[model samples]
Target: MNIQNVTVIGAGSMGHQIAMLSALAGFDTNIHDVNEEVLKQARHKLNKIMDKWVGKDKISMEERDRAFEKLYFTTDLEEAARHADLVIEAVIEKLDVKQDVFEKLDKAAPDHAGLATNSSTIVSSLIADVTSRPDKVCNMHFFFPPLVMDCVEVVKGEHTSEETARLAMDVCKRMNRTAVLLQKEISGFIANRILFAIQKEAMALYEDGYADFKDIDKITRKALSHPIGPFELMDLSGIDVGYYVMLQQYAETGDPKDKPSKTLVDKVEAGELGKKTGKGFYDYHSRI
Candidate 1:
């Protein structure tokens, strides 16, 4: 597709990193956020991160300057999407909000431009119908910490055409990400589905009084050789995010078991959203 301009909606954790990666890959990247404060924060955070990379000799100062030059930020959504060859929506994980953004992008972006979402679980088919170019819409799910995560899931929704999927894969390649192709759409995709089951079982063990949460984390790390424990991982990813994802899954399947654990719900209600909030399953306030 020879994508040149990449637009990333939302300046949150994922969106900023995705835009930075796109710029690093030599694509002119535009990042849009409705909130001006968020755009400022993203710009500051990205600059700090790039400086750190340069200090560590991971990227040269010239490379960092070039990347920063290619990056642009704005509060205007249409302005960001106007001439974008690829629009990757990384907004909040609400179906209605995503549908609204996609609908507008369909009109604002050029007809030949491809549309994609960075949603972890929500399928493009569920939102594609609202847009005129359903064939161009697909899921390009990037993992958390987009800068470090090398794998991107390229999911093909029912209405998504083969050419669109291939173009998304190519886009991932251009961003220096390895694209994992999913032939069919599924909730939680592959990695999250497996991790969800493990977390469910871990929570069950803790709730059943078989082990302490910390012990379970220790066991998983020691026995399974995982870098982080389930609870700690939840803390990193934010309990509120997991809570909403579980609620979305339950809403879709109408199954009580799909609901989030009481522990997660309680933490979220207490306003302990995880690293961002300085508290989750663990306390980050003291350490940080």
Candidate 2:
């Protein structure tokens, strides 16, 4: 279960956070992406976070230096996964793309190494089917803010081994994440399912003309103690991303309730995609 080197196969927000946390937790973390620009951005983002940690006295200079030192950057996927004790795929949330990646990992990953998917909603079974060694594959879904969030959903594929799950759980522990093993993979896993259910109701309320966006958000913050409302979370997470997930949910569950709101579709179409683009349910691009 002990790991020295971990390879994160994508250098997006979650992947970068995973790389930083893994390195901070004493693993030689390697991050790889197809694009060089993304790799550079990931390093920049992690360095900024680490600087903030140092300023807050949350991490010592030695620890920060060690984290930066332990992290290796790469653009070559095969080379990065070759010697890694564990490989975590955090690429786009597409089943075929993920399956393609895992098929390669089946060849590249070490025999004893574990393979995990950071897929938020895609079924682990589908991903494992494409993997030659399904027994070594499982879902290790970390939330948006990997460094700050503690919950790591350890989803077990039907054919996934207990040993593999144990090792994956141990890996989460090393990264200081709370690992909760789900006996089976359900659509949206645990957190997302609960989250979307609430979202469905909210959307219904807004669509039925019972409430407006700001009022719903204000009520949730004041009454539910939720820092951000579902709409706000969707904006931060990317409206298009949330819309795609809702579509996937509808396709899987055959429930109309899982369908996303028209406002989300319109916003995405208008290219007003949440925080990344600086606007969605709100605007941030102006820095006003």
Candidate 3:
């Protein structure tokens, strides 16, 4: 199916960037958030990002203007998604919350519209049963910093149709992302499952007093030839996000090890979320 009218639910970092990508690809994109303040901030952030891209010669002024012309923001979910050909949900990672969104989207969105979740860990199967249109539901997981991250995982849930999967891959191609198709559902999908294994080991090393977090980050980056270390990536992804995903996994599998690390839980409880909150494993308050 040709997805020309795109709607993104949520206006957080991932949501706005995905919406921007849709607009840049010449799709009519609508970004929706429950809070008007968040929508306003997302609009400002998109403009600033476009300006920076233009300044760096990454995109032309005409490209920026054309994207803006096709992009819009709204506080109403139904209003944003009613006519949309695809609704990408980029909200928080809680399963219940995602299910609520899918339920609402299934009711509000056009019948032919495909519903996709940008969740990193949770699978669409957990959310799809809430709606009657399970055949049209799938997971289109985007990595951190969606603008720069070129890989997007198009995951197929139990009821997701081949057409839905193909349409998702097509949408990824339109957004300049390399689509990685997963024929089966897994909790964290491909990239995140591998990254989470690294995270578990890194946390274990820190707890064992093998190395400080900074040293661990430095050594992993230097020795492993990685762009960023596990701790740093965790901080970038939000400690709370990791904590909740871990908890969700633990709940699903009853694995004691899947329970969030004490350090992560403590940091999240203390409200040291990540770059968004100005603090995490590393402090961005001073750096930025």
What would the TM-scores of all predictions be?
Answer: 0.98, 0.96, 0.98
Model 3 gets an lDDT of 0.93
lDDT of each: 0.93, 0.87, 0.93
Lowest summed lDDT across 10 adjacent residues in model 1 is found at: 236-245
Give a tens-digit lDDT track for model 2, residues 130-249.
Answer: 767889889999998898888999999898999999988998888888999999878899899888878878877888999997799989999999999988888777787788887777
> Clashing residue pairs, candidate 1?
none
Task: Let me know the TM-score candidate 2 reaches against the reference structure.
Answer: 0.96
**lDDT per residue (tens digit) for residues 173-276 in model 1:** 98899999999999999999999999999999999999999999999999999999999999888787788889889989999999988988898899998899
Residue pairs clashing in model 2 are none
Local accuracy of candidate 3 as per-residue lDDT tens digits, 20-57: 99999999999999999999999999899999999999
- For model 1, state the Cα shift of residue 74 in Å: 0.7
RMSD of each: 0.9, 1.4, 0.9
The alpha-carbon lDDT assigned to residue 288 of candidate 3 equals 71
Clash counts for the predictions, in order: 0, 0, 0
